[model samples]
Target: MSKDSETPEERRERLRQEEWKDNLGGNLNDSLNRGNNGSLVDLVGGLGWKGTGILIIVIVLGFIVYSVFFR
Candidate 1:
């Protein structure tokens, strides 16, 4: 049915579906490209496999440093 002939509920549903289709993968791509520095989720999402590996190595080294010096 044309948009003008649709009931309010049907129009809302149709628009919602259209919005979802338009934004498909857009949010994921945006989040991956523009990660928030303060958010761990964003950080991990933004970092691909290699970056995540390096991050894990850095965390391990940092923990070792703290253990050796702070304790």
Candidate 2:
């Protein structure tokens, strides 16, 4: 069957498998080692440098916009 015809449950399962496959580098249970000793930086290690940079920029810009316009 085509992906368009997939049920919601089937679609979710397919996406979940794809994400784990891509995220875990071939294995499912292997997780990132954030050796920052359980600090907030550990969150960034999971996301890596690029993702952390983008996230920080987005958050800072969003906060600035919100403070300027919404507050």
Candidate 3:
């Protein structure tokens, strides 16, 4: 039968199947691109201790400024 002639249930099932296939394709693509050794620790490790020290300084300065002005 033609698509236009299909019942509502058949149409809904077809759409659901298509969505499932699309999701599977996306997951496969992401996994293949990620490879091994790609993780949160690797990302944070790139920043290292220098970045962490800079971030801490900024936070402390921000707190001091807020207390002096707003409080």
What RMSD does each model have against the real structure? 13.1, 10.5, 15.9
**Worst window of 10 by summed lDDT in candidate 2:** 27-36
Residue pairs with backbone overlap in model 2: none
Candidate 2 residue-wise lDDT at 70: 90
As for TM-score, the candidate ahead, 1 or 3, is 1
lDDT of 3 by residue, 1-71 (tens): 88999976577668867876779977576567657547544454556668867877998999999999998
lDDT of 3 at 50: 87
Question: Per-residue alpha-carbon lDDT of model 2 for 1-71, expressed as tens digits?
Answer: 89999976577668867877777663423333323245453466568679989999999999999999997
TM-scores of the candidates are: 0.42, 0.40, 0.38
| Sliding window of 10 residues with minimal summed lDDT for model 3 | 36-45
lDDT of 3 at 38: 72
Off by over 4 Å in 1: 1-39
Best model per TM-score: 1
Q: Candidate 1's residue-wise lDDT over 1-71, tens digit each? A: 78788976576567756876789787566557556435564466578568999999999999999999999
> Which residue pairs in candidate 1 have backbone atoms (N, alpha carbon, C) closer than 3 angstroms, thus clashing?
none
* Candidate order (TM-score): 1, 2, 3
**Count of steric clashes across candidates, in order:** 0, 0, 0
**Position 30, candidate 2: lDDT:** 38
